[model samples]
Target: MDIKLSNKNLGLTPSVTLSIDAKAKEMKAKGINVIGFGVGEPDFNTPDNIRLKAINAIENKNLGYTPASGLPELKEVICKKLKKDNNLDYEKENIIVSNGAKHSLYNVFQAICNPGDEVIIPTPYWVSYPELVKMADATPVYIECSEENSFKMDTEVLKESITKNTKAIILNSPSNPTGSVYTKNELEEIAEIAVENNILVVSDEIYEKLIYDNFEHVSIASLNDEIKDLTIVVNGMSKAYAMTGWRIGYTASNKSIAKVMSNIQSHSTSNPNTIAQYASIEGIQGSQQFIEEMRLSFDERRKYMVDRINNIEGLSCIVPKGAFYIMMNITEFIGKEIKGKLIMNSVDFSELLLEKANVAIVPGKAFGSDNFMRISYANSMENIKEGLTRIEAFLQEKTE
Candidate 1:
């Protein structure tokens, strides 16, 4: 019998960030000393208070399923968080909690996209954005944002991309690979276009708390009532609370969209983890000292990485205003020979670095740009120091 897999998933590319991290872990298991700057998750453990709350729930209360949307208390806390942080007022009816921010994104696409609908995604985007759009049966239109522009979408380019078939546009602040935070002024411009075109804006603010250099994270939805109605804000505890494994993310939108997402999640995953939902309540309402400390640590690491990468002979990167990642420019080394390997693209550079220097990183090709590689400063100070040192030595071995 000949069995075939679904055509929908066949074209999906695996996550290069996770793939590199996994390979580094495997090498470490085999006694190889590999330094990884691949995964974007914080290296810090979940805060003591939040973990204690989970323990208390597990020991005292019955850990079971929650409402398809979320716990009422948790949803209330999320609304309060939105009001406090983003200056956006939302009621419980406007929220839908999912397994992770990625899940929230999936639901947003599925909720709005029909066949042939176009979602405008900026280049050097999160690796999963285009794939998620494709999975929703939508076409992902790209606008290549250059490094000189800080990798942000241009309002004029955005205007030209819109069409009758345009359904939505994704806006990621403190963006994943580039760490570019959208300013309030820039958001207002995009919000104007979105409002005029009646295009939905899926504003992803997962790195809102990880900002550095006094850069403020502006939610496009919070700019005005018109854009707010056309926006779905996605956020979660994974980045800020070091709760990646807990699998909790949420979306805030209009009631009609929220209801549709809630219904879809009801039959699909039922609910996010019950215990996690309860713990997230404490995470939101508890003291915020941990978040401050984590942000300071990430800022320090980010500074060190930017300076160190720039000092290295063949590598340089722009100073990221937010998030823990730096898009290291390797264009200077392209078409050159390094340690007997011809560096043709980001993938070639990354593979050779991993094999020669034992330092793992994600190629920019994964993010629709092939001239750079993404390095996360989420690793320890010692590991980052050692990894960059190794990289410096490896690049110094260039043959031409």
Candidate 2:
């Protein structure tokens, strides 16, 4: 029997990160030792204080459906945190909470994008952006950023990508797949371009609290009022708070935009989990000492992993300024034979690494870069050391 699937269902691709993670889990179940560097999640448990808050909420019978935009108290806390940390002012009415950062982003697209609209996305972006744009019935236009520019999209390229049909541009800092964070000057230039063109900017700052080495994250909307009116700031507690499983995220924007997002949420998931919202109030309002500790650990691992990969033959990596992933360029290994198997691109190279070294990493092709692969340093220091050592040995053996 043949089943007909709708175009919307047919066009979607399974998440590449999940696919690699599933393979790693299968290998582990078969009793093979596998070190997974493919997942984008943090390795730490959710903090004790936050967990206690959630437990208290359960005891208080806080499990019912809250407001679709979020609990009022939680929204107020979020607004206050925004003012204190990012120097941005917002009222509770300007915020809309969702299941996670991903949900907030998708809802934003659904609320704003009309069919046939174009969305400008910088390449080596988060894997879900282009697909989400497609799901919204919009086209995704890619602007390639080279390694010479630290993998950041220049203002000139952004300006050129805009057309009468372009509705929005998606920006991710402390970017996934590549850990490139934009500088204040670069952000100002991009904001200027967006203002000139009257295009919307959807800034994903989920990794906002993970910056290291004296680098500061300046919100693009905070540059000026005009930019603020045109930008939607998407953030969550996943990375910084190590609460990925809790799935609490929010967006702050112009009142009209927030209202529309809330309406969309009202029909769709109707509110995020009530306990998660209660816990998120604690997350945003609590002390950030845990975030700093995690950031320092990630910084050390980032430096160590980049140095180790660069020391291996036929592999090279640029030191990332923020975030916990290293995008390693493996162009030198393309077209080589690995154990009689043809290695042609990042995908082939990743499979060879898994088979030969028992190390799992995501291919850059998943993120729209062909000659590179992403290695996440969210594992323990010992695991990172062992994985890279195996990678180094695998390369050396192949070369010999």
Candidate 3:
């Protein structure tokens, strides 16, 4: 007899973003010339000083497991970084370091949500937010954020979505698919709504340092004491430090929530990697040079990608203020034929690009927006230019 699978694991929709990335890699393994616009991590390597610290930890025999939450030194650095950069204060006891920001969010949802609690998520949300809520046994309530509004949810939507069973709201700034960052005024209003309703706010600022055009990131927790009490700030060394492979991400919340998450982690994965924790200490406290250089490079690519996407016929894009992904609006191509393939939606469009043009991009339906496709410019300028050129040629070949 076959063993029955658990309900939670059975309910998940495998991540579409990662699926596309894997397929692109598979094609390239077979020696195909596939230009990928699906990468989410920085193309830069981890700064030398940070990597050296990790090496030092292993070389000095400091690789043993420390605490379930995190290394105290890493937590302390997180606290200092919060106060200095995000204007939020937290003690070491209030932080829990997890395998990655993704894991941190999964733990936060598990800690705060109950069987049937509701989480308000704004779409086009990061692909994982809704799934993470489901994994926590909570209901995901989506408020469709419009492109005209820069895809940022306002207070009015929040008020309408909240109910007595509402448990929390997940906020991702410098958002993944849309690349929209919330202004301080908007965050203040959102924070006020949570305060009045006695609800929790989980702010995911993983892309906090990748912002462009001088758009400063504001944490909802930093608005006031009331929201601070209700907010959990999630960040990591992945995006900012180009340490995605190191797998270190953390959460800052009230001690009660942090303690419970730590308890849960202790019984589960124990601590995050010991060497990675040591490296993160240096990542936060060590340097300003590589961060600025990488940010500048992304900004240049962001400008070029937006302009090129807009100029293409049957395609358009709003200039993303932060993050590295551009959501190309492909509404005009829907119901149209390209090389005998009917582009019914963003997925079809994405498939056509991959099959015909040897290009890879993600469908917007994965982010809950069906009329657009998300593309990453995290590759070299040569690849980005070549990828868009192929897409342009493909469109012209069919439209003409």
The candidate that wins on lDDT is 1
Q: Positional deviation of 371 in candidate 1, in angstroms?
A: 0.3
Question: What tens digits encode model 3's per-residue C-alpha lDDT throughout 1-400?
Answer: 9999998879899889889889989999999999988869999999999989989999999978889899998999999999999888899999999999999998999999999899999989889999999998999999999889998896787799999999999899989988999999999889889999999999999998889887899988998999999999999989999999999999999999999999989998999999999999999999778988998998999999999999999899889988889889999999999899888988899888988899999999999999999999888999999999999999999956
Reference-based lDDT, residue 46, model 3? 93
In model 3, state the lDDT of residue 37: 89
Backbone clash count for every predicted candidate, in the order shown: 0, 0, 0
Clashes of 3: 0
TM-scores for the candidates:
0.99, 0.98, 0.99
Candidate closer to the true structure by lDDT (higher is better), 1 or 2: 1
Clashing pairs in 3: none
Backbone clashes in model 2, listed as residue pairs = none
Report lDDT (CA) for all predictions: 0.93, 0.91, 0.92
Candidate 1: worst 10 consecutive residues by lDDT?
391-400
User: Which segments of candidate 3 are over 4 A away from where they belong?
Assistant: none
